[model samples]
Target chain A: METREMTCINCPLGCLLTVTKDNGKVTVTGNTCPRGEDYGIKEMTDPRRTVTSTVRVKNGSAVKVPVKTKTDIPKDKIFEVMDVIRKAEVKPPVHIGDIIVDDIAGTGVPLVATKDVE
Target chain B: MYCRETDVVIIGGGPAGLAAALAVKAAGVESVLILERDTQLGGILNQCIHNGFGLHTFKEELTGPEYAARFIKRVLDEKIEYMLETMVVDLKSDRTVVAMNRKEGLFSIKAGAVVLAMGCRERPRGALGIPGFRPAGIFTAGTAQRFVNVEGIMPGSEVVILGSGDIGLIMARRMTLEGAHVKLVAELMPYSGGLKRNIAQCLNDYNIPLKLSHTVVDIKGKERVEGVTIAEVDERLKPIPGTEEFYPCDTLLLSCGLIPENELSGSAGVALSPVTGGAVVDNTLETSIPGVFACGNVLHVHDLVDYVSEEAENAGRGAAEYVKGQKAGIVPEDDTVMEMKAGKGVRYTVPAKIRPATVKKDVLVRFRVDNNYKDVSIGVFYDGRLERSVKKRTVAPGEMEELRIRKEELDKYPEVKEITIGFVE
Candidate 1:
């Protein structure tokens, strides 16, 4: 049996959550919402996080265009995804929702631009 | 010298100014002009490339630029007039604005109403009063952010941030993502001044240590930042002796705080609230100078730009009403105004005065606390009588809270002389 306490990052409410696992059964308490419970369980099981970053832009009004993962990627792969983003570059006239990287870090999560660059 | 006249003139082109102009146009104001000192429409939002914006206004997470773009698109679509790279030098009590730009050497505009949306400025190291030699590597968190996110320049290899403000917390994660070692973030207050979500995603997830009740004691380096000395602060915020710890770093980023920019407001003879460091206004968001209105950071530092836009819209609408009233040859009747007083644990509230008669709808009184409290109830009193109380799970100084008082409710208390807001234990 093991127990872990963490702050739920689902939203700004930041509910304090305690998760306990016994015999492969998990119990989450101190959460105000279902999203908090889900966050606690996933944080304990396979922690994942959505990555927001900027990639180099070529001939754009901005030197860098902000990008983020379409969905949460595995927590352990954050650095790998960041490394790829750091080395990647995009051309001008990039539109929002444009995929900057496909299958980022083999996580099957695409990195999409958050803002348009012209 | 050139002279022009407009019904309403907005002093900035940032989120606040853009929203104000749009609102004025929507309110049926024909002549509205926005003057922006920056080369672009978006102000500080241009450098704030990180996400987590517009969740309230747009119902979706967005970057600063994305949020500003939404407003810019509307402004362009409406064909609102605006001048980039134009700076207003002076504003008079009569709504006379003296502005300058390269294209227009010097120009003056007389407006029926003016909205001050100059925004706020980051507190620099000089304001912190830390004993230090003039170093080259020191920069405010916002400046560093602009350099990295906008200019694609690396600030330093190792960074030590002072003050756990949102900007500082965001920079800690940003520098780390850019391959820089963030030693730690030191905050003077026992509790962090940043949003809880930022403390989680920006620092906790990254394993960046947040030292509460700690501050930078000294800065070491002559030409560049070689290191910084940090020490724990006592309850009085005085540095404790013999608790100094040194971290070798190339850069020292200060995210101490933000001050509302009100230089023009002062020149316009607007009465400012010492607590908010901004102009004092009534429920209509009109300053002491009747024709001038203020909102956004110029009125108070806001945690979210969404709120800035909302408040700017109110100011815009207020200015439009004032302009229309003036053109109609109608003088505003002096109505009974009630003063709003901040009680225990409450810092200050915007719109320090409330005129129930002029209020078209409910008035939102926004305020902040002096410290963090958990499971507390906020009480609103009308002339020493408890009117309403709201239970909040948690409240902190970093986040601004609001209590809406409906005019319909105020109508019941016609003889109300004062309203007080405070935290109930």
Candidate 2:
């Protein structure tokens, strides 16, 4: 059996979770929220995150409009994900909520503009 | 739809916005409007069911909603104009905000000065890299608080906490009182991030053990949270071997930390300070943008709600004062902003940019250290000369450190352009 201790990031309660694995079965204990189970398993296996940052713009008075990934992506693909966003550029007079990168890295998460760039 | 114009348009109807509204009223700005995304005026305070708030400003014990109500009631008494269920969809420097609601399908408000009091948001599991099976037993501290206090729902029978922040500490007792067997409140930090009073009242009062220098290393479950593993950590925060222990439970709550909600501010071309993850503001709480101001958790992660209220009032009044042409008219003196960096046991400081003499307000530098210490003094240096000093009140990396530089003391450094603050023997 393999066991591990983890902090449940599901809530402000920050429940300490105990994970015990026997053969192929996994058991999670110690959490006050329902999301802790999902958090723990994903954290142990394939971790992902929703990256939020800015992308360069062309012929725009403003430097950049802050953007974020609409969906979480695999942790290993963060740098590759950001690289695609950095290489991309757009024109000015763009409205807020404009999609900068759609289906980025096949995460199906669109990088949307947080503000207008004119 | 009714169209309106104001000198200042504040977002988020929480205590921060309410305090800002009152400050604008005090500054004689009649054309001020507050747009709240929530139907209730009190914001999240309405869901917080515990006490241990209002220590600095009120010198009395109060609950979250009660503390927020103080400002909300004042906003009503002041007759501050506000719109409920209004979500600001678009904000632009041209002084316009595209807001929408059920009552008002689509509307716009124009203002000269804008205050961002959107407050801070809880960092969720997705932010933390925890491997686990997708189940229904995980929740955030704020979400649990809402469920327990507002919806009267008991999340689980057995629980364990991961962070030792004030919220996590408070929830330890809250969950216990709600008839849950709380195993432990583990923190990666050596000391607690919550106030001293919370440690005694919340964890200690309930016989709940708080394990320091501990972290959750692993999790397990298929349908629900079946268990969690905790381990001691070394100086680098890497988990140490031979110290792992498994605790069985059905749920987990996360209170790691709160991040400032700056998507809107960052989008509006507002510069942010890495220390607090908020905006760089001058003494008047005005951002780099001439007519923009910020306060509350949106400005920085505050230790108390009282401080948030204080800053909101300052931001509100600053916007009002600027609209009235009474705020600081001097430019930043060409990047003459002071910088405060933590030393040996220090971490980060806020208000990343300090505009000298912009206002007569007493300057207080608030920061957090990197570790726990005894008998230390925080020193402020201007060009290698001692400028101000404050005695330590048991400085800990978990708790924020506040150092005051009186107006007169700051005035002494007439030629000082930049300053650095740190702690020394």
Top candidate on lDDT is: 1
Where's the lowest-lDDT run of ten residues in candidate 2 chain B? B326-335
TM-score of each: 0.96, 0.74
Task: Give per-residue CA lDDT, model 2, range A11-101, as digits (tens).
Answer: 3334567877778677788755667788667766676655544566777765554455665678666667767766777788775568888
Q: Residues B1-425, candidate 1, lDDT per residue (tens digit)?
A: 89999999999999999999999999999899999999899888888877778978988878888888899989999999999999999999989999999998899999999999999999988898999898889999999999998888988989999999999999999899889999999999999988887898899989999999999999999999999999999999999999999999999999999999999999888999998899998888888898899999989999899999999999999999889999999965757889888987899988899988788779999999999998888998898778889998889999899999888778998888889899765
RMSD of each: 1.7, 18.4
TM-score of chain A of 1: 0.98
lDDT of 2: 0.75
Q: What DockQ do the predictions score, one after another?
A: 0.60, 0.01
Weakest 10 consecutive residues of candidate 1 chain B by summed lDDT: B331-340
Q: Model 1: which residue pairs collide?
A: none
